[model samples]
Target: MKDKKQLFLSFLMIVVLALMLPMSALGAPGNDAPPDPAYAKWGRIAVQEVKAKYPEDKVVDYLHVGRKTNNQETIETFKLWLEGETKEFGVIIDIHFDTDTEKITNIQFKETSR
Candidate 1:
């Protein structure tokens, strides 16, 4: 009876260890790739405006060109690369907003090549 009990306990221990091994492996820490940066509200709106203005084209790439501030207003710029049925080009969009109110005052775009 003692030997039988010992053998059963040993088998149970082995089963438990086998089950836990995979869980531990999954939980172990390792290098994980960083998540991509999310686009800001102005950036999203710029993309939408571009799509609207060029319905036949598709935006392929994006770049946030940074921001500038003055006494009464702030300016944010973004560059977007687009692909059309006939050609590929880039656009620079400028968003001007009030510094105190944070309201958009103007939006402009300029097309570029390369």
Candidate 2:
């Protein structure tokens, strides 16, 4: 009877440890994950501008086309797809900002069918 009790206690200890292991892992910090890219800010601006320009349409998709940088300026390009009650279309937005100050220099938008 003593041996059986010892075996049952060992099994119970293992079960408790197994349950705690996952909880500990879940609580651990995720410091190793990468941060957001520099163009993330520009992407958000593009979306907002599109929403303001086409309030009747719903933004269905977004894509970061690319970025171009000169000595004093940087332009972040994005393509956003919008769906309206009548039709769907794409808008390409170019967000130009001062490289050092990160201030908006200009915002240009072009609409496309495809």
lDDT of each candidate versus the true structure? 0.83, 0.88
**Candidate 2, 1-114: lDDT as tens digits:** 686467558767877997887677667577343468978988989999999999999886788999999999999999998878777789999999999999999999999997
Candidate RMSDs in Å, in order, are: 20.1, 17.2
**TM-score against native, each model:** 0.65, 0.72
Error of 1 at 27 (Å): 8.5
lDDT of 1 by residue, 1-114 (tens): 686467558767877897887676667578354454443877888899899888999887778998888899888899998978787799999989998887999999999996
